[model samples]
Each structure stands twice: as C-alpha cells, then as structure tokens.
Target: MSKYWNEEIECMSREDMKKLQSERLVTQVKHVYENVPYYKKLMDEKGVTPDDINGIEDLHKLPFLTKADLREAYPYGLLAKPLSDCVRIQSTSGTTGKRVVAFYTQNDIDIWENCCARAIVAAGGTKDDVCQVCYGYGLFTGGPGLNGGSHKVGCLTLPMSSGNTERQIQFMMDLKSTILCCTPSYAAYIGESLKEMGYKPEDNKLKAGIFGAEPWTEEMRREIEKSLGIKAYDIYGLTETSGPGVSFECEEQTGMHINEDHFIAEIIDPKTGEVLPEGSKGELVFTSITKEAFPLLRYRTRDICVLTREKCSCGRTLVKMSKPMGRSDDMMIIRGVNVFPSQIETVLIEQGYSPNYLIEVDRVNNTDTLDISVEMNAEQFSDTIKDIQKKEAELVAAIKTMLGINPKVHLVSPKSIARSEGKAVRVIDKRKLH
Candidate 1:
C-alpha cells in the first residue's frame, strides 16, 4: 500500500484544493501587502493592490520576483514579519553572488517540515526507520529541512553533515540506516567508496535515498540505484521557498508532486513573461500561500520544466512537475548553438563514463572554444597513450553527435575532478574573466 504523511491534503479533490489555495492566497497577499513595504512598493509600481488579487487566478497579474530582487532586498527587504517572530533563518551558498537569506517563523518551520515529512513518507520512510542525512548543516536548507522532517516522521535521525566519507559509511553500517539523504553526486561518490572498500551493494541496510539540491540525469539515477542497492528518489525545493519539500517523488517516479495546498505553480514563457497552458515547457513560477515570515508571490525559479495534472497511481491529487530539463540561465550559447550540461551528462553515462565532468568555455581570438574534461572510470582507464587518446576521440564524437557541436574531450584520471558535497560546479566560463 502507498503510504502518505498527509493523505487528506495530498488526495484532496482539485476543486477543494483550489478552494483551500484561494483562501490561503487571499490571506497571504493581504499579510504581505500590509507588512512588507518592499513587496508593497512592487505592487504599487505595478498598480496592483491586495484587493486586486481575489484568488490563485489573479496570481499571474502580480509581478514576478527574481534572484536579482532578492539580492536587492538583501537581509530585510523581503521579510514579512519582525525578527522576534522568526525562529530560524536559512541562506543560499552565495557562490554565485550575494547570499540570499530566508527567515522562518515557528509556524513556517512547522509547515516546511510537514512538507518534507510527506516526501519521506512518499519515499517509504517510517518512524521505525533510521534516516541518515548527509546534506550540509547550518545556513543550507537541505540539512535542516530534512532533519526536521525526519524528526516529524519519528525516525531515529543521524544529523551527519556532509564530508568524512569513511565516517559516513561507518555510521550507515553500525546504525543500519534504512534511508539515505544527500546530493545525487555525493551519493554516487559514496557508492564508489563503498565498492572501493570491498563492500557489496547488499552489504548495507539502506533501501531508499532522497537526493536533491542539484540537477541529475535519469541515467545517473539508475547508476546510483545499482551501486547502492536502493531505489533513488528526487526531492525538489529552494531556499527562497522553504527548502527541499516544495515537491517530491512518490512511489511512481514519473514526476514530483508539488504540495499544492501550500504553493501555487505556473509555467511561464521565459522571454515573453506570458503564462503557458498545462504541458507547455517553460520557466517555473511559484507563490507561497502558507508562508508567514518571507512569503514570495510569483517567484521566478528559472527552472525549465512542464507541469501535468494527469492522475497519478499514488492517488495524490497534487500536480506533478517534470524533472527540470535545465536552467534557462545555465544554457551555454557557443558558436550560435545552445548547449546544456545535461546533454553532455546523458551522453557520458550512455558511453560508459562516470558522471563527473567539467566544461570550460572561453573566447580566443574572438572565436568561442568548447572544452570538456571527463573523469575516466578506473576500470576503463588506459595506461597506453594511444589507447587513452582513442577513448577521448570516441567520447568527443559521441558528445558532438548529441550536442551538435564539436568539443575537445580530455580524459582526466579517476576522481581527479573535485567532488561536490553540495551542488556540483560543472561550468567554468573564462570568457567572463577576460
């Protein structure tokens, strides 16, 4: 039987779910317009008022909030409640630009954890299960969000932050952790380490894994599943919208079910800013109806995906979002051709290579150069220079066939590329530096 943490809400009829969302959205809009001057200014500039938003249908009329807006707001610009009311704050890694800090009241934390608990339950988690979380702790939402959810599910929680691979494996063996939570890349690395230690796939007790905070291909999913002897599940969330439980995969892994009662999702044309109908692939937009501290209305997520209302076998009426094909911002335009890292990753896995690879793009003599360095699996590594050159040529041809752009492929030593404990850094655009 498929288990659910909140079946009543998850399986609610579409009419009833919309009713609930409409009510919460009305109240939330009023709350923000009254308390958040920054957002109020945005509404004023757009000539939109709290009264203008009658329900979810009016959500499209509101202006979208982007990452640039968050940076402009900085610490207090988007906060809807006073600091005293907020019990916690989580922040983005800020590797790209200024760190975006998100505040959460006690109520906000409770709701966020409940959303994550639903994900855990959907992934076959129970109070009797031991959950091991390897996502980074403090500031980052992945660790704290899943940690709280594990507690809500009454599971024996291991708050192991990322790093110390040997120690992480030891705890998994000693405590018999049944559920593993971490980034898909780190999970892949752990699987490699386990095999290196001579531990078979069945040597551990983990049955399922919740991997997120980064984009991963379906080929990588099967790799992790075979290497770890566990079913891999994807969880989606952002620090701006209360972390890793905004949506999650159920028993049926076709797509992740968005928690509709708490959030309203829309697919919008990235260039035109027009709302697209269901099944149209475009940028994702979200409105947090239940958030109290930092409620974002029509936040632009920049993720390219499609939403489907098709009925699911899990019996959850929540709408499902297809795995994000790629980010609009991450798409690389080289030689007048668009290329995404995911396309390269898919080809790599299909050609019997590890998922670890780095892409470098630069402009030399005003001509764009595309170079890719892929980590060769130890089992496939060749000591002979001729053999290794042959391998690189073969991979370059495969990638060219997929991307329609010839790339210079260099096969690096196994594990030579730095592994990411959080989100992997795959692209190096030296053109920006120049």
Candidate 2:
C-alpha cells in the first residue's frame, strides 16, 4: 500500500464501511458506559442504555454533545479512564478562560498516531521525509498529536511548536524537512520569510503542507502553493476529536476523506436539528467510535460544510467533505446575504493586496454597512496618496465582483492589521439586531 492522501481504507465498499461503523459504535457505547460516569449518567437520564446505541444509523436517538458540555465537565469529568490510565491530556487554548479538555490513554494515543501516519502517507510522505510540525504543544493538541504521528510513520519529526519563524526556517534548512504542518496563515508567513531571506522555492526543503485550525479559502491555497512550492492540504479536527487527523486530503486534492472506520460524520441543520443528506450544506457532526479516553457522541463541530459520498479519483472508499467555508457561529447575516470574513480575505488576496485585512460592521441610518480595511503592500507605497485612493476604489470594485456585495474599502499602511499567530479576529460588529 502506498502512503498517500488516499488510503486503502478509502476504497472500501459502502456496505463494508457501514457494517464496520455499526460494530464499532456498539463497542464504543459499551466502553463509555463501563468507564466514564458522566456519559453513563447522560445515557441513564435519557432512559437509554449502551444497547440503545446499536448501529451508526441510530445516532440521532442519542443526546448530542457540544463544546459547552465538554467545558462544564472540564478536565476529568468526561474521561473514560482513570488518571493513571490516561497517558496524555490536552486542553483548548481557553482564550476566554473556559477550556474543553480531553484525555488519551496509551492505547488511544497509539490510534491517534496511526491516524496521523496514515494522513502523512496519503500526502505522499515516506519515512525518509523530514516532518516539521509548527503547531503548539502542551495543553494544545496540535503539536504532540502530529509529533507522535510523524514518528510512527518512521520520519524524522521536528516539533517546532509554532512561531520562531527564523529558527523554524533554520531547522528546516538544516534537516531538509519535506513535510510542513501548521496553520495556513503561519505557512504564508513562512513563505514571505523565505522570500525576504532570498531563498528560491526550488531550493527550499518543503514539499507538502498539512494546514488547519483556521478557515481559509481555495484562493488562499493557490497563493500558498505558488509561494512555497508545495501542495497545501487541509486537515480537519479539534481537541474534542483527538486533534488533527480526523480526515485528510489525498492526491486528488478535491476534498478531505473522512476516516469512516473510526469516526462517523453527519451533517445537520443547526436550527431544525434534522440530518442533511449528502451534498446538502450544513453544520458537521462527528461521533467518535474508536476513541477511548474521551469518546464523544454526535459532537457538534460547528463547521459549515457539504458531505459527498461520491467516489474520488483516488482508490479510497472514505467519504469526502468540502473544506469548511466558515463556522456556523462565525456566519454573519449582512444586509441579506450571509458573509464570512474569509470571503473578504479571498477577495483581497486575489486582487494582489496583503491578506491582512479587517471588517468593521455598523449601522448607517437604519441599514447595516461593512467597512473593510486592508493593508497595502510596500510595492504600492511609492505612488501618491491619489494613487492609493484609486487603489482602494479598485479593491472595493474587486470585492463586489467576488462577493456580490459592495463594501467600503479603507487603505492602511503596511503592518497596520494585527498579526494573528493564533485565531484571527476578522470582524467587529457594532450594529444592533432586532
């Protein structure tokens, strides 16, 4: 079996995958009932037993778990094993003081590592390739999860743990790292750094990138690939789902192939709570059937996506989901059309402006209008202020062409926008909704 974005498991027959999911679901239900008291109580409160969750198709009968539920349980509330049994624990960044934590038994960690190895292999990675992971470690799951996975794949792994771009580049050059892992924005920063250091893309060691933890557009992907000389692939996951590696991109590069044997994915309308069929746009839900330390049932991911069971060019039988266009929580009802800030980023990048931009929404008279502030690159500074004004007009015109809405464009100096090392706050809404 070739190690690439599409795995041998992806090509499994539909009947086989469903049967496997059914067996795993039953096993996971029993595992949770016997280990975690919190889940047992939840199941009991609903007058349901582990046997009630017999098959993957019956998932809707069970209670849905949310991030808020995980927060309430905190560190040990939902753990399926005793503290000693769990070899590792990871927490959300907790930027707002309330963090969702997850635990991993030694066996759980091994499964996670294998999934990551499969992801690497799917993206054309081999044991000889050096893996440089730039995700943060400690309570955050990105670093350690991928770190373990890289090693499992027999690659020399670099746990860079985000930031320190210069040092990251230095180590990359020294080690000749072929696989890069980090947020897409950070990858963009690294690409800019390479250019500033007078390095040629062909001479650099990077081959492919596994990017996630932020919402990005296909336009951004083309920009990254063009600048870095690497095919940037999307990885979908969270701490609740055992970090990244839940799904991965294959050589087809169309969409991410979900790991059906481990996690059952579903799409549903957040308002009506009805399951959306494949090809329908809605929020993504995941039920972890193989996770041991913290198995989540019907966990609402809040990511907006479309699921498709269509066969891919790759030989994998795994289901594919579109790249998350935005989060349900992050969707803004502007005027009439739904607007995601990444939409603006896509437009700005396409217009040859800096990707660093912001959206300020406020009420004008009675209607809401959005003011988009974009940073001008150094290349545009040599011109007069009048030229800058004309440039802003051109940007506004371009955004309209792309998003089908007109927004006020404000020109700012280079480096005016906040540098986002973590989650980027793109919108500031001041309008009052009735």
Best by lDDT: 1
Q: Write the per-residue lDDT of candidate 2 for residues 27-78, one digit (tens) a residue.
A: 9889888987888888899888877777887778777788888888887778
Off by over 4 Å in 1: 382-386
Q: Candidate 1 local accuracy as lDDT?
A: 0.93
For candidate 1, the C-alpha RMSD (Å) to the true structure equals 1.5
* Model 1 lDDT tens row, 124-199: 9999999999999999999999999999999999999898999999999999999999999999999999999999
Per-residue lDDT value at 371 in model 1 = 95
Clashing pairs in 1: none
Q: What is the TM-score of each candidate against the true structure?
A: 0.97, 0.91
For all candidates, what are the clash counts? 0, 11
